[model samples]
Target: MSDLFPLTVRDAVASRQGKRLVGPVNLDLSGQGACVVLGPNGSGKTTLLRLLHGIARLNKGQITWSCPKAEAQRRQAFVFQHPVMLRRSVLDNLAYPLLLRGVPRKSAQTEAAKMAERIGVSQMLDRPARVLSGGERQKVSLGRALICKPDLLFLDEPSASLDGRATREIEDILQSAKSAGTALILATHDMGQARRLADRVVFLLGGQVHEEGTATDFFARPKTQEAAAFLKGDIVEC
Candidate 1:
């Protein structure tokens, strides 16, 4: 695994039309485990992940990764909730990134197939990715993200719309990824999923971090009323 740690965020913010959508927050994800971002809709979880992955430009402050810019970009991967697929076969979709990275075509093909099999999408590799069901497309997107064996993987509600079996498949793949030393940063509204996969949790409310702690601690004893209410399924507002 690549060393892509010591990630530092200082006063990061995301804004749109002069309205702050997230942050002015500080965080240090300098570890080797899964960090889950928790929040309701519009609570900034998605914005935070996008900012960290360099998809969204920060409106304030800075994010620093220990690795070189090019290396870090190559070593990290992001999968959005509603993953978009290319108008091509699943195998081709998975292989495209590797090919861009200069991996030989034969090797990329083999790796893509292996990833598909691992994610239970092997049977659909030859099928057009755009035609796959939502769950299958998610699997292919995740598989494509992992095909390069990224050191850091960011997921935005990866299983939000999947059925039980599909969710479990994603969870199993995530666990395997964790075991292989990939650092996972996931954003989800699913408390159960966070409990299952999180080493630590960051609770965002009103575009800011309301609380952050170990999964056990945050779930057992949230620091803020917002967090407490959220845990109870009550809508919390800033």
Candidate 2:
């Protein structure tokens, strides 16, 4: 978020074993708030997020950010649909990252406890993270990711298979993150969730971006036939 505006991508592409999975994508993202990536299964939503986060290599294209590499790396965070937890307590899991950054033990514990409260996991702080339920683990993962106050956050199918209550909690957390000047890119097939969180929408189909526009514009009138069919709840083939 530190003047890292105008994130540029040119001819972005991703492939595996010579099979293109996502790409020929180009984007310019700036400012704060959430940018939602919407599409059905195998539409390259996950692949796109991974590629943007540097977790996956792109077969072609250039991505440039104005910020320093060290700054971006330290201020970026990613939370997956199914979060992996450590064997330690939930509080310990939250504190571990801070400890690695050289935060004092007492400060780390205090911040972890505070984050637990903020994310509605205060009661589970002492419990082993590995023993928590799926919803609880996801909450902890979100808290852990946000504990550092990241400038950019990425979420892929964050609410997949989660109950309504859990999903709402995640949405609320996203709202808070946006308010704190954290830029977010979330990928999901849930149109309702996309409507709630997106400032902009990126529609992917068959490893390509079918459409990109404001949430209001894209949802009201998708430019492509594929996007239109998708919004109407019809199945589409890439």
Candidate 3:
């Protein structure tokens, strides 16, 4: 696990408006299989991803990328719960990142097209992105993220708003990506989704990690009461 890729965090903390969203946390994620972060709402899952992506400033401690930031950023792609699309064609939207990175136009277009096909949205490449349905828009968003061939993928509730079929489609794509050697960090509340996708699980509560272990072990026998209640559909107190 350590031989392929490595990520480390030590006593990391993020605070805003007199609230500590994340704190005194220590975690290490070697680039391997998918690691799912699970917790109730307001448990700081989104903020943790942002911190790992370097989008949010850390208020304390350290996050060191053993690789270069640009390299890391290029090797990592994040898909938000509510994806934002530019007012451009689907192909153009997928091509935007590569273009900003100075990839040649022709190559970028080719890559975008390939990704569009892979995500099952090739036929809509010429359509305006804003006009797509919820599932279609999310598919395009996934394409945009994958076009870079990122080694690390951060997904914040990718299937949260999708219908059953759409959710299954996204999950299938993620499984394919995982088999292709991409390490995933997904934050989700869906227990079934987690069971299907996660190799390891990190259970967070009140801005702190409550349990971390193999998905099978964590789900079957959660070490913490909070996790136990969460899995049993009981409301947990912060």
lDDT of each: 0.89, 0.89, 0.88
Off by over 4 Å in 1: none
Cα miss at 47, model 1 (Å)?
0.5
Candidate 2, position 81, lDDT:
86
The residue-by-residue lDDT of candidate 1 on 106-175, one tens digit each, is 9999999988889898888899999998889998998889988889999999998899988998899999
lDDT of 1 at 119: 89
Which prediction has more favorable lDDT, 2 or 3? Answer: 2
Residue 148 lDDT, candidate 2, scale 0-100: 88
Q: What tens-digit string does per-residue lDDT give for candidate 2 at 56-158?
A: 9978988777887566667789999889998899999999889989999999999999999999999988998998877888889999999988889899998
Model 3 whole-model lDDT (C-alpha atoms)? 0.88
Weakest lDDT window of 10 consecutive positions for candidate 1: 1-10
Mind sharing the TM-score for model 1? 0.96
TM-score of each candidate structure, all chains considered together: 0.96, 0.97, 0.95
Candidate 1 residue-wise lDDT at 129: 97
Q: For candidate 1, what is the lDDT? A: 0.89
Instruction: Name the better of 1 and 3 by TM-score.
Output: 1
